[model samples]
Target chain A: MSDFQFDKIALIGIGLIGSSIARAIKLHGLAREISISTRSPLTLARAEELELGTFYTESAAECVKDADLVIVSVPVGASGAVAEQIAPALKQGAILTDVGSTKASVISQMQPFVPEGVHFIPGHPVAGTEHSGPDAGFADLFEGRWCILTPVEDTDAEAVRKLRSFWESLGSRVDEMDAEHHDKVLAIVSHLPHIIAYNIVGTAEDLETVTESEVIKYSASGFRDFTRLAASDPVMWRDVCLHNKDAILEMLARFSEDLAYLQRAIRWGEGDKLFDLFTRTRAVRRSIIEAGQDIAEADFGRHIRHEK
Target chain B: MSDFQFDKIALIGIGLIGSSIARAIKLHGLAREISISTRSPLTLARAEELELGTFYTESAAECVKDADLVIVSVPVGASGAVAEQIAPALKQGAILTDVGSTKASVISQMQPFVPEGVHFIPGHPVAGTEHSGPDAGFADLFEGRWCILTPVEDTDAEAVRKLRSFWESLGSRVDEMDAEHHDKVLAIVSHLPHIIAYNIVGTAEDLETVTESEVIKYSASGFRDFTRLAASDPVMWRDVCLHNKDAILEMLARFSEDLAYLQRAIRWGEGDKLFDLFTRTRAVRRSIIEAGQDIAEADFGRHIRHEK
Candidate 1:
């Protein structure tokens, strides 16, 4: 049997995730034809130059014409705009999905415009790097990563299965959950971590007592790790903060409360309290490694020091 | 001229930093012999199994006997205890230094115990990995890293010069700073980041809305980055928090205050404010890369997503 799943796969917003999807589709021969589109003419041209897809267009509507699968891979903030532009062009019975970070917001924004016959399955592939753009993507970006799907109750079961298989072919472990739960879980795991990293880097930058040079010079001590996350695409993260406002706010509130307790312990020189919390947190990392969510390599296997 | 700077070097702790120093000393032929000691008999045995030094002992005093250079590499909290144990045995005119993260407190703890002729200098190598123990040590742990020395005003200048040369031979760029300044600088750069990472990981683990499995499954989004730092040795970090309480508390106050401001910005839906802060922090990462404090590789150059 042929491995081809979709006759035509249209990818809107050819950034990191979108380009990676295109590459994976090509690598796996999952789609017979791939069409790519983005709002920016330069990005579209770049995508074309990179030969990421079989067809390239500046119009989302033109890109999605006759497509069996339309994947909206844009920032969460741009979801509604892309949806409206492509909704009329979406083929009947086509599966429409997204690879946004915020599932609930993206669902809300796109569900209104999605045609009645189209299967609108909102998803978030919990995989990325700080770098974005077509050049930063690789075919294996989603491999060994989890891709979550939050389909509405009335969505066709067969459509959901097909979509799950599509992601599986791309080497993602697919799981289904309600949109609300996905948002809440992601708010804690993804959104809040990025916000905290961005906030801490900003805090270090604005310090009057510590110069930027000093902060950068000594960053490898610990601060450099935060900077890696803080250096992520600002627009995508900004959209994540704006779209997933309530869930992120809730997580932030909890994080701050915990931080306040830690601060009080530090102030009082409560060594036992500090040590207990520190010891408890270490187990989380071990669990992540055991679950295969992270590599067991030392220092992320950076080869930081030269061999003697 | 022969590069052998010391006839005998004693390492008063056999953990990561201490063993790394032993390896570096041997790699560079900087010392004729190395005596390794730790409070724990098991750790001493492990150090001996690794053949980290020419001699190994459980007695800190015995380790320091007849040593021309003595490096106390215990946690900051244990500095005073180790100092008192080895003080009477320290050779006259020997250079006594430490690799504690904190400076002012370490100096205060060890300075009074120093003999009349021993040159007491407190130093910190702004380098480490999340892993601990003697096996985690490598010869190049200090390569291309900074080692800050905070010598007392009345300390011998020749002793300081020899110590500088010693670290230079270990491949570290050495800088001199006052103990107070070193404490403050490290407070913002090192201590606060670790504390914040620990606090955030703990908060995530305690969340009622998100399951631990969900957090681990979706960690690649951003949470995994913090876990790397949070996975660090708990005892060392607890000691850091306790020894640098004043500086760490001050930095924590600043960090919490700044985080509060960010919290307000997100709660108020201030996208522009969020974008500006995110954009500004990106520059710091670039500066760190340019300063060679961090690798310019993407995604921390993790071979993550491979080996499936």
Candidate 2:
């Protein structure tokens, strides 16, 4: 147990998720050496300035050379490109994982470039802030959050266990599932909600009757909640929208259909229908709270978090 | 300054908003006597158990008798009936107000029943938790928040000023606007967001491929932000939908239109279009944070608010 540290760990793409993993690795002393790389030179410089890694490189290939663990934290669409860059450099028996939101797509994108002995496990930390970039990351970003790993059938169980333990060391509770099932689950829980949020905030911005000032001033009413998700990284979410197209479109159709039903009910003065739906959703909130997914306090505990 | 408080204040509904007002009044000693009334006997008994007022009664008329201030905090649909019940007993020169989300409809619902000398100022505190009921309120609910007062043109100037100061004392910044304008503003800022939240949550719950249990388990990924708004008081939200029908419907139409455009972009693999829209929306989020309407921390500062 005392010798369970990695000889070398490499991080490709040092955005919020990547940098967070780097910080967590440093804090827990989980690795003998941390190699960090990102496409943007400015970001690499910032990462070095922040002292987030023991080794900094702009080339993904150079950074992952001889590394024991390699974590790719890029947009889903960039997974393949990054995987191709670092494939030859990944050490034998090294564990390769990603923190992409969509598992099936990332796995499919990154799998073809994988070396024979490298274990490619697709994982998503299921955690984030609306903010992005290296500076936005923190050590506790993955603390107590669910980190899901979707490995193919032929993957080695020992390699999977090692990757799971790595995430656990970062304070994550890990779950294992198939990639397709993970995509479907994330479509409802993550992608659809983000798309809805982005769409609604876009709608508010285009409103002819209500000024943008009014929306911003009174946003605490509810619109502000959606804005947080809407503020998420564009390139990442766009990739999610494109990669998870079927699932999202399915969700959008169902959500629109449900919304249309609600619209008709509102038009026809069907208070009972509205009341029933609203009440039912409240139970879902309570369940999330009970499951420790969300806080039980009112307004997300704004009064306490935003104490003036 | 000590003598500026109301001699007696009557609160017609003792739910979240009303009870918060009761607590704030007690904390600030803003009224010589606080009289509370609700149509439900059980809630009245509970308010008594909580000792929220100097007087408790079931009769709205009896509650408002001789009160210098009357605040009717019931659902918008019930505003008319509450006004009718308490009008005859309202003292001359009394300042009357409400905390309904919709302004124009509430003013219409409550206007005709107001006595000639009673100043009926329709107001919305623009503050709340998703939780409801007498126990789900606190004095800090209104602190650093905005309270919009939609006083009709014929409302007395002194009465408006007095109501403004009263809300200010409770730590609110008061803004005066036309009732119709207030309705339009709230339609975008509050009603549409909540309707969309309720609609999406319902959609997730009714999913065929994705189980409700999965949504509950993985909800921390964006879906949970929405469940907060969806968990709001059902009856109150129902009333808001019915009374603010036109504005809400209009905004819903716009939102759906925008969503269709987004869906098309997603389906066509239009990354640039998706990225552009996503990027534009992030600015709205920054504007909201800058306006001091929401907390700047990530995930609504959930980490700080929900410390494990």
Which prediction has the highest DockQ against the true structure? 2
Candidate 1 global CA lDDT score: 0.89
lDDT of 2 by residue, A62-113 (tens): 9999999999999999999999999888889999999999988888888999
Question: Looking at the true structure's interface, with contacts defined as alpha carbon pairs within 8 Å between chains A and B, what fraction does model 2 recover?
Answer: 0.91
- Name the lDDT value of residue A45 in candidate 1: 91
Residue B125, candidate 1: Cα error in Å is 0.5
Alpha carbon lDDT of each predicted model: 0.89, 0.91
What DockQ does candidate 2 have relative to the true complex? Answer: 0.84
The number of clashing residue pairs in each candidate reads 0, 0
Best prediction by lDDT? 2
A144: Cα error in model 2, Å: 1.7
In model 1, what is the error at residue B52, expressed in angstroms? 0.4
- Tens digits of per-residue lDDT, candidate 1, B145-219, equal 899999899878999999999999998999999988898899988899898899889999998878999989899
